[model samples]
Target: MAGVAMQLFISHRVASTDVAMAFMIQSMAFVCFNKVSTAQYFVWYLSWVPLVLPQLVKHSGRQENKGLITAAIAWPFGLAHWLAWAYLLEFQGYPVHLFVWGAGIVFFAINVWCITCLLVRVSSS
Candidate 1:
């Protein structure tokens, strides 16, 4: 389901960065809307993250925080790690659901920041 939608989004992109961002955004939305998320869901976006990393690293920006852009893209994985660990602990009868929810909020915010940066980049170009 998510995989098919992700493919459709990625296939329509005309730019390398666009493709990478498409994958990232699609994966984020998929996980957000789904009932359960596994580490494999994170892998879907992490695989494409590297494709966009070099572009961000090489991007020449005067007012942009290249580090923020990078963090925006990378932070989701860290949150995913927490989510996975939290889920593991929860399965062991610990009350750590708040960690999952908090990670989700943070991930969404970081993604929004990345999307804003991308929009600004596109508009300026």
Candidate 2:
């Protein structure tokens, strides 16, 4: 798939952890935008998160760099919001397709913002 191709290409071009993390974030975004996404799909990228946690925490420790900290927290919060909407639509049989779609779009935006923050930190460091 395209994600695999992207990973392979990125791996060949750069051997930095920042690039690896970027690839994982991009893969996660791809799954988020897919027509059908399941909880398990998240594992593919989530597994890589811990590897970068130290880097993220290090950057976020600076009080002036509020964006990194906010992004770190917001990413998961955005996921939870999307999951709540999805759960309502899937389990409660609510006519909330609009809400689900809206949540998904918002989540995608959050992902973009988070990735931007990550890349900025990576470039600066």
Measured by TM-score, the strongest candidate is 2
Instruction: Supply candidate 1's per-residue lDDT for 32.
Output: 46
- Model 1: residues >4 Å from true position, as ranges? 1-21, 73-81, 84-89
Give me candidate 1's TM-score against the actual structure: 0.55
lDDT of 2 by residue, 1-125 (tens): 86567556545533465766666666665675577866688788878777877766674546436786787688788889999999999999999999988988888888777756665666566
TM-scores for candidates 1 onward, in order: 0.55, 0.71
List the global CA lDDT of all models: 0.61, 0.72
Which tens-of-lDDT digit does each residue in 1-125 have in candidate 1? 86576556544642454656666656655664566756677677667767766655566576765645575657758676667757767777677677677776676666556655654553343
Q: Candidate 1: worst 10 consecutive residues by lDDT? A: 8-17
How much is the lDDT of residue 109 in candidate 1? Answer: 67
Best model per lDDT: 2
